[model samples]
Target: MDPGSKLPLSPHIQIYRLPLTALLSVVHRATGVALALGAVLLVWILALAANSAEAYGQLYPHLASWYGQIFLLGLIFSLYLHFCNGIRHLFWDIGMGFDLEIVHRTAKFAIFAAIVLTVATWAIAANLEL
Candidate 1:
């Protein structure tokens, strides 16, 4: 190695076009982490509810606010995505969906199912008083 030679740089995300399965794997892990974080919010709400109705009432308005709604939406999507991807992984454990085409199709379907299920869940919740 020459002392004056430029160091070789390793390939990075910018240098690679990740396949759909790779990207979805990343998203699945990310959503799993996000859901863990979201659990804190759920716990906070539960604690407030358990303490007193008055305390819960005070926090409820903020949760019902626009920013809160966005957070809930993100949480709901994360839940759905993680759940669907988990089912995908389960099928893999059962020795199914191993083909490259099947993998790609299932990844895409997971995303679509998450979106549809999240919307459906919110729709049903919206109609109820809770």
Candidate 2:
């Protein structure tokens, strides 16, 4: 190795394309973070509810707003995605679904199932009144 030679660099982001499993792994970590933030928000809401009915009343409208509904939907999707991927990981831990084809198939299935579950959840929630 020449001391004056430039070090080799990894491929640029624009040139690198992640496979489905790799992308799912990244999404899993992101959703984990999102879920943590959602937990904090949940705690704050619970605290408000416990404090006074007035405080809860003040917060309810905003939460029921269109933008708030969108944020909640994203949170719900994140939860399902994280959950489905976690189960996939559990299966892998148990010495199953190790083949490359099986791995990709499960990754796709987990995503598809998560989407369906998220939609079903929101649909059911939309029908119930407080």
Query: Model 2: C-alpha RMSD to truth?
Result: 2.8
Quantify all predictions' global Cα lDDT against the true fold: 0.92, 0.95
User: lDDT per residue, candidate 1, 56-101, as tens digits?
Assistant: 9999998799998998999999999999999999999999999999
Candidate 1 pairs with clashing backbones:
none
Q: What are the TM-scores, per candidate, against the unseen true structure?
A: 0.87, 0.89
**Candidate 2 lDDT by residue in tens digits, 1-78:** 798879865566677898899999999999999999999999999999999999999989988999999999999999
Question: Candidate 1, after superposition: displacement of residue 72 in Å?
Answer: 0.3
- What is the lDDT for 110 in model 2? 98
